[model samples]
Target: MNREDFWEIVERSRAEVGDTRDAASAAAVARHVVARLTALGPSTAVEFQHFYEALNEESYRWDLWAAAYLMRSGCSDDGFDYFRGWLVAQGRVVWEQAVADPDSLAAVGVDPDDDMVDCEAMVAAAGDAHATSTGDREAFWAALEQTEGDDEPAAPADPAGEDFDFDDDEQMRARLPRLAAVYRPVQ
Candidate 1:
């Protein structure tokens, strides 16, 4: 599946189910995606993983980090994952704009000052997609039920986490002046 195809799956799933925050809703989407992708085999899995990775990388920006920080009152390590999924589900325009310049998100209504942009449905849908692609049936459902604020096990680990320096709030603020203006760093 290509990026557009992956997005179609997500959109269709969301359209059908409306919300994916609960395990039942997420699992329903997971079943739909898994059933649809089953015919294509592992290539579909690889494509989903690749698309998800690129989306993850795209979100590794100061502006988006600041938006996530303000939205969550300080984003946790796992919160970044949900944020990336949320970014992807914002659809092509927002995704492309954010990738090109994270500041563009402000124009797209992702202002750091507004903390009500809930991305739980998007996050759950992406988790379901990952579950379908990887054949990890239980993990996604279990993740949906989890209440400990831990990172959901949507996909397997990628060792490239060492590449970003998200911990440096000062540097992020320097990079995103607009976000800095609207959001005070949460100590």
Candidate 2:
């Protein structure tokens, strides 16, 4: 598959994962990934592992793929370290890139800050929110949370509060601005 096709498959697979997925559902997602990879071509397990690892940089579901690849390739520790390092590096790159081109932030409705916040912290918080969220709203919140800021402990959810449904893509997009606003760096 071409790059567009590959991403389409990845996006479709991501859409399949739900808030309360069971083992079987998880397996189905895995099967979809494996099928997509297989269609791409045969590679050494190690090569496939690396492909998945790199893909995870863009696709969150590929995080598990990277872990599985590392395990199957006998590089679990290396995989973990590599993934962590890659994320740390990515966080920095994103921050620097944003700093270099302040206008880019406008695409996401964020203003450039002379004193940018901690990018890593912002990314981690976004990632955490994404992990706990469901559907497109989850993706939106995650994307919004990607910014420069100090890392902070996530506030505990109120037990008495009603949980929001995150299944609709439109709802997610609508909430993106709010989520992004939370991570805006203080100038």
Candidate 3:
């Protein structure tokens, strides 16, 4: 499927499922994508894998990770996957903005009262399906590693003397107030 078609499926699943974080919603979308692939033939599965990988890569920004930490306390490697999936579910505008500059999410308007939109369910589901499609675990990862590459290398520290604490919630919020403002779940 083309990018538009792929996004439509994601959005439609979001509309029906509401929160991708919900296990049921993510599973539904995963099933839907796998089912749709049958019509296009086997190659589409690979294509879907590539698309999902690219999206995952696009979200590998420190800003987005800060947002994820705010939303979920701390974002692990897998948590980042879910975060990117959630970003994708926000639709093209939000996804594009985040991809361009993750910090821009702070400025983008969002209804704070709305329930957490967890797009990761859909994304993880797609990736899971792709890996399972061929039943070759080793080859699957080997292929993904080749295409996805290693996670972005850590940035060199500044020579000046300022230190950044990624693990500090307060620091993250101060650094990305707009993003923290919108995504911090109301207690």
For 1-187, candidate 1 gives per-residue lDDT tens digits of 5788887766665566655433345445555555555544545544555566666765665556655665555776676666665665555666777666665555654445445444544444445554656678666445434432355445434423233454466765666555554565456
Q: Point out the higher-scoring one by TM-score: 1 or 3.
A: 3
Q: Return the clash pairs for model 3, or none.
A: 85-119, 86-119
Poorly placed runs, candidate 1 (over 4 Å): 11-47, 110-174, 184-187
Residue pair clashes in candidate 2: 117-149, 118-149
**Model 2 misplaced regions, further than 4 Å:** 1-3, 15-24, 43-50, 56-187
List pairs with backbone clashes in candidate 1. Answer: none
Q: Pick the candidate with the highest lDDT.
A: 3
lDDT of 1: 0.56
Using TM-score as the measure, what is the rank order of every candidate, best first? 3, 1, 2
Least well predicted 10-residue stretch by lDDT in candidate 2: 114-123
> After TM-score superposition, what is the CA distance of residue 157 in candidate 3 from its true location, in Å?
16
Model 1 lDDT-worst window of ten? 155-164
Cα misplacement distance, residue 89 of candidate 3 (Å): 3.1
User: Which one wins by lDDT: 1 or 2?
Assistant: 1
Whole-model lDDT, model 2: 0.33
Clashes of each: 0, 2, 2
Q: What is candidate 3's lDDT per residue for 1-187, written digit by digit as tens? A: 5777777766765566554443345556556655555444445555666776657665666666666666555667677666677676556677887766566765544444443435555565544555556655455556555655467443333212233666765776677766665665336
